[model samples]
Target chain A: MLPMFSGKLCQCLSVTRFPSILFLGVIYVAYVLVGGLIFWKLEGCSCITNKYSLLAITVLKMIKAASLSGLSPDSNDTADGFWKFTSSSVFAATVVTTIGYGNIIPLTTAGQIFCVLFALFGIPLNVVILNRVGKYMLAIERNFSLKMMWWVLTFLYFVVPMLLFKEYEGWSYAEAIYYCFITLSTIGFGDYVADHNPAINYPEWYSCLMAAWIFFGLAWLALLINHSIDLLESVNAYMRRRKNAQTQV
Target chain B: MLPMFSGKLCQCLSVTRFPSILFLGVIYVAYVLVGGLIFWKLEGCSCITNKYSLLAITVLKMIKAASLSGLSPDSNDTADGFWKFTSSSVFAATVVTTIGYGNIIPLTTAGQIFCVLFALFGIPLNVVILNRVGKYMLAIERNFSLKMMWWVLTFLYFVVPMLLFKEYEGWSYAEAIYYCFITLSTIGFGDYVADHNPAINYPEWYSCLMAAWIFFGLAWLALLINHSIDLLESVNAYMRRRKNAQTQV
Candidate 1:
């Protein structure tokens, strides 16, 4: 029975000549861990913020001093404008890419109007730019092997970013990968956003880095999608031809 | 000055023979308003909820009754499962469509894993379905007038939904339009979600209606995109040919 089982396993192994998928998967995981470590060093470490405790203490003092029921928190006072330079640029990038995390959406009427106008023109402009860049990428891709292209996409564009986000955003592995997948798929679920934690003071360049990553990553994704559509169309045409021949016969 | 201005306007109008863009713009506005009114009638009116005041009263009573220094509100108790049938269906639709509103996400590891796997297969399936349906839409479109196609797509799909969401969600006109545009564009910022107000009781069929709208609306948007891309490519080819001819000359 043992000999027969060993024989069956050997046959299964022989049937699949190369374990390319498994090998790629391992490399992808390793790339994320190592890239995360590198980014952790570069982005610097974070210290705990005492703001919450301070606010709690202040609030308690205020409550104790004013014993009357006339004290109500003004909700309007809590609403702060998030239209800083880095945030605005990130918002703009999200709009053009169709990610639209909407974590910091435009609130005022004029701002909303601007957002619509920007999207009206920006979406097409983004598509044009991506197509032009994709042409150049396609030219470059043709010179490289298919495995090499996959490695580049998997390692640098995808895996590395996953770990980098994990390190910077302090999310678990699953959450990090989830965020990356969601964003790249253009499913910008704004649930787990990078640099959203008020306690952690991220570097000035972080948002820029994230924006650049999204731009290049999306271009690569577009190339992959285009290739996929082409493959599907050719297959479809071949199947139609077969069907037509069968009918004629 | 008036005569010269009128003459200049006449020349501009002549240069652009058909005011198609302007004519379409008026129809689009009218469609949204009429659609909004129709949907408002169908979805029913809303009343204000007293839950907030009730909660405030309870909290105040609690504080007065108990020497609350030893008591703290459990944040965990406030967290309830949002994964009801209707919500789950909406969430699934969002994932497949790559809309990912992130208003309600998978909190468990098992759910998150399932989400990733679902998205992996679902996005491709969605693309394939859209392509097949788009082929039929193309056939129908070719048989009909272009203006007719625009009216159908604009009035039935885009304009109608804008109002429906406004009526149900109680958003302003601008907000409704913004939500529709954001969603159809697939940005899906999710700043304004339908049936999000806990105060108002939404009908069971509301979410199903929304899911259907998104699926069919996306198909129309996809067709529009394909047409635009085809036009752009042809224009690109013409420009390339002109450049080649100029170079040869």
Candidate 2:
């Protein structure tokens, strides 16, 4: 009985950790493929080396990246037998996270009321989510200090790409990183949005390919952050338990 | 020595909490008076109904009510200096909290990178902030056992004025709440923004007055949520410690 209980506990933990990670992975790949295709079609026959083409490629990259890092709400087990597709919790999560993506906005009076209510609910929900994430982060720091790991990983993931983009894509290192951050954060201020390169006429397929790359890149960045947070919290929690046990003895 | 130490601690606590609270209080009062005066100058024409005047009066009243009852942020220092005012921490808190009032956005490439870094920093900062807030909320819940306090407070602060505006000012309840939420959240979708009511004749002064109200009202809501979270977390932590100590014996 004890073995079965422990096994169930381990299974539950693994399930929570891995399912979302895997799901996000699948979604991101799909997003990259689709977004890339669309951008290729849209920007093809345009100047690939021109400023407009460069901008188009950058924008497409952002879209693919964002789609990959998308978040979904945890499903609750309620015996009520009625499926609530849009629970208040989930709605709150989406809006507060700024995943606005413009997919949903309140159109009616009730809808608007619900929107406000959702935000109201979301403010705390965000807090709760962050708390859990924090716990995991502390765990990681205990095992392997996050500062050191973060610096190393950031160098590989962000700094390297930034330099490459500057050299090959004609962006300044600062500009590339800037674009990367803005898109990943989903601010999408649109002030410095990418435009198609006007100089080089590329095929439609190539244009789409560039677009897919941009979106997928952003999505991956978001995913990396989420995963890191989870890992950190898990490590922190384990350390805390160990310390507590030692203290009690 | 013990007495002196306790006294000093109390003093420190008061210094942290009282000043901010007083500052916010003063701001709230000034906002109401200035807002009311502006409305009076701009829209208090002879053609307007007494109800319109009353509605304006109640708007001020609701603002006050909301300020006092809503989740208020710690006017006091509940955490160490390491967590407070760290640029990265502040940026994270500001973004994740959706206080995106547009007072600031990434202006330069460096700034954008900073923004993303902040978002990364923010995920952890959010955890700390939420845990702190949750403790306070738990305390309140224990004392009152009123699970609906937040809901009730939200209704009074948000829903009531919205409903009143709909009935007296000829807005649909949905529209009023939508206006309230969008303005409060600072999402400012700008899709359904409020213009001058017929009574106000869309005057410049009225427009300015409305803008001021929107800004302050949004600040008030944000502060309220921050406060509530802190309160809940403090309470929760205290309880958890107590439980642990009891178990140790």
Candidate 3:
């Protein structure tokens, strides 16, 4: 019984050559750990800020002082222009686009309600706008090979935007690239925001340009993700057919 | 020339029919404005906690004190548990899931890079999981009419979760239902968070349940959204055919 079980396991292992998924998982684990260590060093090193400060200071001390006294450094930024005309415009753009970066939020009850209402119209309007833009892009991209289309999109969507973001935000190339990926994927982790700080002097038309950029960039990403799904579905269907054919044979 | 112009205008209006989109836009504006008023009354009326204090205190004065004194209420919460195990896990779930409320954030640079890496694997894994779940739902829902599918989904995704959340967070039924809509739509404004403050003494299994809720809830939403697209596409195809037939006649 043991021999038969072992034989079946070996056969299964042989059928699935080169454990790529397992290998990727290991690599991913290592990558995230290293990232955590780096973040711990950069942001979480001190009790004045980072969460790991509890390691040095007792938990009781942290809770007592932090829960009261309003001494946390992060406090000042949360409500910074939480409501203002220009920021409100950006807020509307972000929410409707479904980026919801949570950088500048509606802390007031009114703001939260407005957010919902804004989303109802804004989401549908944005969807219609994005679809229109997508149809145009698709028409232009027609007859292009998938590889060529990808390269063109990468050039237009990723490269140009990364350069612009780096220039406007004074972010490092890595940070700008990271921001592009986060925003385009709509994962929108609000850590690295562009045109957020009013103290930073940007172009007068900066907001307008940025909004247009987001609109077009998101449309491109939607197209790419949708196209990728089609490819995956076809591949899946082909695999299923082959399996059925093999079984019948 | 005037008669010809009038004839063209009439033709355009008839083809467009009720101008439903514009009517919807006006209705949407009214809905959001009403929402804003309600929220203002509920949470924005006071400044001790709400960000709308500037409406009373003068922006210049608040900015001076806030910019200098490091006394932003939001600061304390941003890093409340920015790096603790449960918070980090919650952060991971939020980030990959793209529900980033920004209620908590990694202030350090290292945390940002780690976020990028986590998202790389996590997003794809989530997409695959959601797709599989969507497939199962689509298979099961094949025989059901659109209205019936929508009703079942609302009951499962919205009503059930709303009840669970209200029980867990002690939020009002309205707030719970609002949360269900916001979260499932992935709007994630961060004003109303569940299970954040450990002092609240929620059920021991609360976190586990919340995670499961998010996973399943997101799958249901994915199915609903996909089903909607199919309905819209079929309607669009039918409309186009009818137009073509009318033109031929």
- Which candidate's lDDT is highest? 1
User: How high is the CA lDDT of each candidate model?
Assistant: 0.60, 0.45, 0.57
- Candidate 2 lDDT by residue in tens digits, A96-143: 544332222334444455566655645444444444344444344334
Ranking by TM-score: 1, 3, 2
Greater-lDDT candidate between 1 and 2: 1
- Residue A103 in model 3: lDDT: 61
Identify the leading candidate in terms of DockQ: 1
Worst 10 residues of 3 chain A by lDDT: A45-54
Q: Which residue ranges in model 1 land beyond 4 Å of their true spot?
A: A1-81, A230-249, B1-81, B231-249
Candidate 1 docks with a DockQ of 0.21
Which digits, one per residue and each the tens of the lDDT, describe model 1 over residues B1-249? Answer: 555545544543443422433443354334334433332332222111122222333454455444445445442232322434444555666776777766656655555666676666556656765665565566555555557887887787767877887777787778877777788778887766777777678888986687667767787777876666666557666765676688699
User: What DockQ does each candidate score versus the true complex, computed on alpha carbons?
Assistant: 0.21, 0.11, 0.12
lDDT (C-alpha) at residue B103 in model 2: 21
Candidate 2, residue A227: lDDT: 70
The alpha-carbon interface RMSD of model 3 comes to: 10.2
**Model 2, B72-166: lDDT tens per residue?**
22312222211222322222333544333222233344345545554565544334333433444444433443557667646755676676556
TM-score of each: 0.66, 0.39, 0.61
Worst 10 residues of 1 chain A by lDDT: A43-52
Docking class of 2: incorrect
Worst 10 residues of 2 chain B by lDDT: B75-84
